[model samples]
Target: MALLNFSQPLISDETIAAMADTMRTGWIASGPRVLEFEQALSDTFGGRPTRTLTSATGAMEVALLACDIGLGDEVITSTQSFFSTMNMIVKVGARPVFVDCDLISRAIDLNQVEAAITSRTKAIVPTHFPGALGDMDALYALAQRHGLRVIEDAALVQGSEWKGRPIGSFGDIATFSFHPNKNMTTIEGGAVVVQDEATARRIEVLRFHGIERLEDGTRDVVVASGKYNMSDVSAAIGLAQLRQLPAFLAQRRQLADRYFEKFPQIEGALLPPRGVAGQSWNMFCVLLPFASLGMTRQAFRAALRERGIATGLSYEPSHLSTLGRSLGYREQQFPNAERIGEQTVTIPLHCGMTIEDVDRVCDAIGEVIGSKKH
Candidate 1:
């Protein structure tokens, strides 16, 4: 049997044709295709000042620059998501303040966010873990109260929404990834969406190495700020991907429904997520009961591999890592994150999965953790 991939991008002939068009245009570096992609994103996601970049990491770096977040600033992010998030904070010369996640939804704990905010806190980088934004409204309110810039690291959130708002729709700034494993792929692209015009303009310039431009129907003015802009080829791919996104999300949600239903009776061993309809279902991650999975996360993953299934630990508690230690953060700094880090498992989930595929995975998981119950 062919191994089910953790995720896959839906790139049909349309995507291929788009790439061909970009190549034919011959201005494939950073041109109309990029603008087309960005406009498509803004229209689809409903955010102003949306600009595409090379990757989410690239977008994040530019967002920090726009915020003037550097040199001793504290940017709060969770430990349960991707490591690149915390690394991006550190890359901007700022200290990444770690926050534990709420045990229920596995998103960052709001109270911890409130506590982590000091005078140095410049931004709150909340993640919608698996596209479920737990207590996101509360998080936004907290950011507003503290006058902190909210930059949702929405890499895993495409269709995700909170209280009718897309995760990227209302943030001060939001960065999203377009890697192959993501709900969509730009052949590798991302973007920074900002609510404010000036910040948005800053990101636009920053993405292209600080070159400011004025389009008077012909002539363009250049400026002294910009770096890391998206290429026209990538933009072309993104345009095609955006058009296919609705169907892509629908398929992922369909599979998510199956997984939730298939494993509902498993009790505490397999807790499913509950949220509104727009969820991206980016990663079908789950937490096994401490009882059933007697072995640690690594051991369970090894067993899954032995059964020809692949698994992964999305991330670890950032506060307990070497960099966190160097920053003087101890394990106690974020106990919830530390625990979730040790237990979270990223199972195979993608738009390409079938009902039978879900069933097979569910069966394998049941076998591994059920009969081996501690």
Candidate 2:
């Protein structure tokens, strides 16, 4: 029985060698390599100002803080995403206003977002769902109408494009993750793309203990912020990953195409929303129509596991989590997101996988769903 892991990083020998070179330099802590990686990301995204950080979560926090979104402020975002999207808002002493997701794209419903805006609302953090780009044009329009800042949680959308422009290129502020399982990897790191130099400098100071370097090499301790800097070693790996991103994206697309072709044959399993043209395909997830199949999501997963095919639940609705409930969020508030959360499951999709691997996973899924029907 072969156990197929749900996700794996695509690291090449070049990436490994870059990290080794950084290790040999002994200037591994937020040095030249980090700046180089930021420059590379900037070049990739049409010269947007970028800053490398410890993690996407940290980047989100810095972005919010830089925007002056804090106590008594309200931030509007979707309920159908990882907790960090909402959690970052809460961490900044702002209230997270929830909006339901669009069923097809799994991105935040912009219609609901406009209605949620109030005078207290200071920002909108719209997450680009796995392999999908949300309606940024509409979101940005809404933000402009309401005088709200827009911070894109683009954790899963490295190299994704919209209307011929890359994701990080046009947004007010876009944060990306370089986690082990994301489209690209730096072991664990993140970056923020800002449209202006001032915002970029603000995030840089806020990310590294609020230290502002004055002219003549004098350092001023500004606000006593936490240390959230990326290591040169990680940035070196990220640079390599950035260089290889096109090939990685191609491989992921090939595997995803195979899954799209094969999964439609299996009954009671629904493929995730189709990626629009120019969208980056991150993780290929499927929604099991458990109610129609007369099985719980757990049972469906267990069945897949019995055949040595591992599966993953992409996310649980943030509004239904412990933190969500504690903050006065009730059940059924965001019905669509809750529904998607219950049924969504991530299967194997990685650069190392082959077309045959996709077939194996799909066949196993079909067998399990078929046995349930009988």
Candidate 3:
């Protein structure tokens, strides 16, 4: 039996050929293909101002810079999210205020978010976690009430939607990741979609060393910025990936539904919430009742490894990390997020997975849990 990967990119030969064409063009640096990719993203997401960047982290940092969220300002975000979401806030010379996530969806709790806002709160960075969509309507309404900017960390939700609108289409700003394990791959790339032209222009300048080119080819130096442009090679791959995104999302949904159906056979395992209308289902994660299994998450993973199965933790809460501790975050500060961090396990879910593969993984999970139960 082969060791099933947690996730894999579904790169087709067409995408490879596109990359080859880009390499042959001799203009593989950030050029026409990059612009094309950005335009495609904008077109797909309701004509938003989208800019491709080297990574989602770069998109996030540039978004913060564009919003002028610096020094003395506090950016509220979920403690359950990937560290980069919080780290970027710190990188932009701002403080990241942690909010707990809801137990069912594992998305940031909007009520907690509203409560966390202070006079210094400049922005809200909500993460659309794996297999779920955060409450965008409520979050946006609260942001409006508090007059805060919203930079959605939509790294896991490229093709996701909310209330009949695409995730990036109507937000103040949203960033996407195209890492290989994501729903799509650009080899390694990301983009920021902004609602306004000014913010879009700021990101363009900030992504490429702060050099703003004038109509007559003159250059204006804005604030000091980093080189974070996506190369044409990557954008070529992205264009190809974009063409296949709908198919990729469909396959992921199929696999996730299979997992949802089979996981219930294993007692004490908690499946993801159902009826989530517009989720991207980037990762199919489940929470194990560790006490019932009489095993730690690591022990269960080791058992699965013995069966030629692999598992992953969706995330360990960012608030419990060394940096979080340095920033005065302690354990149990956000109990729901802490519970999710300790209990959640991400199973194999990707465009490449079939129903049989899903069944094999579920069977392996049942065996592991059954053995421990006996």
TM-score of each: 0.91, 0.97, 0.97
Give the better candidate number (1 or 3) by lDDT. 3
Residue 326's C-alpha lDDT in candidate 3? 89
lDDT value, residue 220 of candidate 3: 84
- For residues 1-374, what per-residue lDDT tens digits would candidate 1 score against the true structure? 66667667778899999899889987989888888888889986684768888889888888887888889899988876677788888987898887788764678888888988899999988777664677766877898899998888888887787778777777577889999989899878888888877887778777775765556554344534446778899898888888888888888888888888785345565454764555678877776655454566776777777777777666677777788788887766667666666667778788677888888887887787776655
**Could you give candidate 3's per-residue lDDT for residues 1-374 as a string of tens digits?**
78888888988999999999999989999999999999999998899889999889999999999999999999999998888998999999999999898886888889898889899999999888756687778888899999999999989888888887888999699999999989888878899999888888888899989998989989988589999999999999999999999999888888888888887475656777775777787888888889777888899899888888788887788888899888999987899888888899988998877899999989988888888777
lDDT of 2 by residue, 1-374 (tens): 77888888877889899999999997989989998999999999899999999899999999999999889999999888789988999998999998898765788888898889898989888888655677778888888888889999999888888898989998699999999989999998999999899999999899988999989898999676778899999999999998889999898888888888887465556676665688777888887788888888898888888888788887788988889888899888888788779888899998878899899988988887788879
TM-score ranking, high to low: 3, 2, 1
Candidate 1 residue spans exceeding 4 A from truth: 212-226, 264-270, 290-292, 371-374
Report lDDT per candidate. 0.78, 0.87, 0.88
By lDDT, the better pick of 1 and 2 is: 2
Error of 2 at 147 (Å): 1.2
Tell me the lDDT of model 3 at 298: 91
- lDDT for 92 (candidate 3): 93
